[model samples]
Target: MPAAPEMPWLPAQLNALLAQQGHALLLEGPSGLGQFALAMGWAKALLCEAHALGTPLAPACGVCESCHAVQVHTHPDLLVLLPEAMQLDLGWSSADTDSASEAKRKPSQEIRVEAMRKMITFCQRTDARGRGKVVVVYPAESMNTVTANALLKTLEEPPGNSRFVLATEASHRLLPTIRSRCHSWKMAWPADAEIHAWLSAGHSTAEQVQGAMQASGGRPQNAWELLQSGFEPQAWSQLPRQLLQGQAGLLAAASPSQTIAVLQQLCHDVMAMVVGAVPRYFSQDSLKPLVAHLGAQTGETITQQLQQGGQSPRQRTLERLAQWSVDLQQAQRTSEHPFAPELMLTALLDQASQALQAKR
Candidate 1:
């Protein structure tokens, strides 16, 4: 998607970086912020035939021929490196792959070395258009060692006026040598107002917008996808208690990684309720019943509950929650494990509820 001129924060920051003359940029941050969109905006500005509104930091005028080519993904100078799976999911043309090998290919989850080789060759060619080239590597951590190493040489010495932007959710995974060669900028969370406006513009219900944002930990892209994926707002509100009770088969729809993430969020909120801290993921009002059900009085606050009801979580429950957190971390590390379909959701919840039970 083209950068929405209305949300100028990311583009404005990118515009400031324009004068640095950095040949490569590493846009590292958690997902949801507009890294990809901002990177494209910067690239298009570099290639645009017309500068926008006469400001040095201004974005490209969207109507020019160069801008049109980039918008249509036909820019001769733009090379995008993404996993084959991401490419297909985003509807980027797969015609770049050799036609003879198409049928035998499994959609790749990692950026393959062959694409890097093609990018290297592309860098050497004369710019088909006179304005120079842009190379975009998105979710850059998807580059396996071999694929990443292939770009190290080029990044150290980018060809001609070509510029590179590598956007990643996990920057620590990048090769240290590669990282040292580029200027790094971390993506920041967008203003809540911007997020709300973006969701509202798409005709999303308030509950859908809120539920999706909470479910996604404020990732706008994730929330947007959740809106289209038919995520039930009601299910999200009631999930904590039902999930703790091992009654939430609806949760089976989440991937293993997502399942663990939700559980972690739930665990965090429950512990937060125990200490009267605000819930981080779910709305506190929505979580009141859940907190009350966990053997806490749910008095005006956890502090009041402790004073009036003479209650504190038993030591066993605390241990169990701590252990559960550890277990979730381990699960996150091995998220690709081929867990059994029938047992995955139920088993995880069953373990959670038992851990959450009050010790007599």
Candidate 2:
């Protein structure tokens, strides 16, 4: 494997930091922005015994054992801490033990105090190989208050020959103390042309890829996921029909998260179409129906309403959508109720319709 060129934005800063004896980095960006991957690459470079490049401090040699280990997720010193699953152990009927061993593993939710304890213990220990260790707390915002505090102490004093990299999509969710402890690297979204090129290289349907990219709000990685997952564009194309036709059954059959996602994408396209910035995927055929559904009157009404709504009506809408996603994820993990998806989608679509019609 060869090292890719340094990303244009913060690579220089990162490169210089790695050249230093030891330093900590807090890479922050939206989910799917590739912060975790970049952090791993940085770690590989830092641990590379034979780093090589044109500059005095160049990128890591991908051929090195350290780089290979990091790439394969087998780096002995690379400790990745994530949330644990939550489930109870069944015993003799109606006899649940209260002992620590009998305690149920908490379903994977947030990074809790227990996880922080393990990280602290690991960081405090002398490395078996006497080489530097790297700790990556990904999705760092998952840390609960207690866990955040516990982790703070370790961050304040990273162990000798160890580096701590906290990566998060929600940097604002972390404590100010935590933010101040490490050097921060913020990432930018990929350009539209760049996204298109990557999608083209993958031999994706140009229209679907373009539509997915726009639907994903220009997030290239998510656009790729939508394509690979075979997300039914028709599921979304049917949205305006369902809304205008008041086909409650259609809404009821969809997942709340998927429904809201579609509605949000529709709203985005509505705005784009109004401005005549419609991407090729949404041109003519697709835009015509969507535009008619949004109609000049309704489109202007809703767009204006959205403006007064907040700094980001889309953000609020997406948050509401995520509630459904979380509920479904939980139900699947627990195998308690499988009807959650249908219920959520119906509620979301119904709410959107009501909101749209409210001005009438």
For this target, which candidate reaches the highest TM-score against the unseen true structure? 1
The positional error of residue 44 in candidate 1, measured at the CA in angstroms, is 1.6
**Clashes by residue pair, model 1:** none
Question: Best lDDT goes to which candidate?
Answer: 1
lDDT by residue for model 2 over 1-360, one digit each (tens)?
Answer: 122233443455566656654367888888766676667667666666574433354567788777787666666777766554311211111122245764564345576676777788888887654457778777788889998998888878777778888889899999999999888877667667866777555556787777677557676666766777564566545645556556653345545555555555555554555456764333355556545544433334556666766434444444443454554454344432236665655555565555333221
Question: After superposition, which runs of candidate 1 have C-alpha atoms over 4 Å from their true positions?
Answer: 1-8, 51-58, 96-106, 255-257, 274-276, 288-319, 329-340, 357-360
**TM per candidate:** 0.80, 0.68
* Off by more than 4 A, model 2: 1-22, 52-58, 84-106, 232-238, 247-255, 264-339, 358-360
lDDT of 1 by residue, 162-276 (tens): 8899988889999999899989987878877778778666677887888888878888877777777777788888776566455764576787777888889888877777677
Model 2 TM-score (2 dp)? 0.68
lDDT of 2 at 127: 69
